[model samples]
Target: MLSSSGRGPSLVRSAILLAIAALVATFFTAPAAQAADGQISGLAGKCVDVAGASNANGTPVQLYDCNGSGAQRWSNPGDGTLRALGKCLDVSGNSTADGALVHLWDCTGAANQRWLVSGANDIVNPQANKCLDVQNRSSANGARLQIWTCTGQSNQKWNAPASGGGGNPQPGGFVVSEAQFNQMFPGRNSFYSYSGLTAALSAYPAFANTGSDTVKRQEAAAFLANVSHETGGLVHVVEQNTANYPHYCDTSQSYGCPAGQAAYYGRGPIQLSWNFNYKAAGDALGINLLNNPWLVQNDAAVAWKTGLWYWNTQNGPGTMTPHNAMVNQAGFGQTIRSINGSLECDGRNPAQVQSRINNYQRFTQILGTTPGGNLYC
Candidate 1:
């Protein structure tokens, strides 16, 4: 076998696989899957556009009435990005703060250039955890676009390229770095990939980003701790209890389980079960999971998303969302009460509850933060 250094010419020839745009190879490790070009219409049927139809960098992106012009044309390259005029739609200054200006800039694969067009039609700068908005909600022509806190408001809604609207989203600004994640779950299953978790972070932008830095670290630790417990240190991909599989489908709902009785069994990091949960998570994330419940287990990003959906939205067997519990300083115990408290909270399952607490403590230590108060539910 030849040494790595001896294969230089062949490696050089292989690297010249294709001649794409100048920054295309630098931005993505591989070539883009597909580029769908179209008009990105926003409020009042106005198009998200480059002001003055200029291809120059730093042109302000704005909202203008649909005019079938190249200035209004955008491209979704199916790599969780939006571009126009050969430049990226960028958040100015690469700031993660809200109300940042959106403009055209050279595509350097920076976090500011990454965007996710959610299923609900919101164009989100995942790094900033904000939506592309018409400044001050104005619908008049030439209203400049900026990144604002997502409120699901009309000004934030958009009709982007169909191929780029759903499925994968750009992942950015995750509080837990890959190094920290690996330290926390050294034995984690390959399926629980770090990229998958970050990719899923776009599904709910405010998850670990809701509060101060300390709070952010705490929230990330709390979530991973719980996930570690759910999957046995992140080793198990699906619920090991095979007997529980067939019992997940409920026939009372208007739409019965189409994937068979056992299809919605406990899967993903949270071990999401029941047909209702699949439907709810799928609906919220803009992916059809009711009939294709297996996506949670099949796709790593989808699996992490199911866990995030439950963490950021659902109250489970307790009051208030887990995110609210942590952000509002309700303590870690409240999080336990919020997720699976019916069986584990109170005096019922102290050992299991303690196990979660133990994991939380370890993760907090790994993240260099305190575990905070409320150790027990």
Candidate 2:
């Protein structure tokens, strides 16, 4: 990744994006409950619904008029997460903050994704340590559902089917949804497609729901912070310095740049540049990026995957990959050292390193985590 004086804004925006995107839910095993069917009615007797009756991940779970529709039917499976339409009732982004939206998602065993019926009027989400709330206590139709401090208000009350609660709570693995992804980037939803990215993470057992909150947040924060500096919060799919584009091809290699000299320019979330990097990324991702470098800008998931591959593998200027720096308690500064330490670390370029640190600090806070010390290389 290359950074110039102009890269300052990239770090800032990347921090904002990471802070929000890291809110995606983390999964853990929970006890399962027997499935029971009924309507879960809340404020004004409105029914909890799978918006548009769509059984898709990140489908908005809202309060709608009760019309004896299938969308209103729910099952309280003992696994802690409420079930309807074969999907789990989830807290958007695993957010504990007041007013975080609720949605129906593929059930993951993560704590935030789990819900328990108190058998009273309250529907409790153990992960958030809050109660399901009707936005602003509005009793009107289409009021959005959110997580708020537990209150004994009628809006917080719920009526579900009676059950001693038997079906095993299937493990809800870590997977990013369209809704959660959008919340992470806020304004950059259209910048990259997330389906492939989400699927890739889900399919990778080693990287999916495999750590504690601190470890998870730190890893994600560290990775995105670096990439944000590289691509400017994914604002640019390719490098802006067009003059430097053609120079990325190293002719000395046994095999010359197959995509042509100018083709191997900086691109994607990590701004992958050089023919060697394109070839390596393409080989790992099972794509022909070396011969077709433009895929980085054309495919959002592919772009994200390439970035992740670098974070997880490359040692660069540091002794360990950025992923290891965070998970091993090596501190965020090490990650900076790993990415572009030669250019910015050891007081070489304090401005650039500080910019990356600023983003890292903000992201950790937004993730409800503390930024460990030694933030500067």
Q: Write the per-residue lDDT of candidate 1 for residues 79-194, one digit (tens) a residue.
A: 55677888889889876555789899988877678765554556766454467888989999888899865555688877776444433432336778899999998888999999
Determine which window of 10 residues in candidate 2 has minimal summed lDDT: 12-21
Candidate whose lDDT is highest: 1
Which stretches in model 1 have alpha-carbon errors above 4 Å?
Answer: 1-63, 66-172
In candidate 2 the C-alpha lDDT for residue 105 amounts to 83
Against the correct fold, how does model 2 do in TM-score? 0.54
Backbone-clash count (model 2): 13
* TM-score of every model versus the real structure: 0.61, 0.54
lDDT of 1 at 285: 69
lDDT of 2 by residue, 255-303 (tens): 7888788887777777777777777667655678888988888877778
Model 2, stretches more than 4 Å misplaced? 2-184, 202-204
Model 1 error, position 316 (Å): 1.0
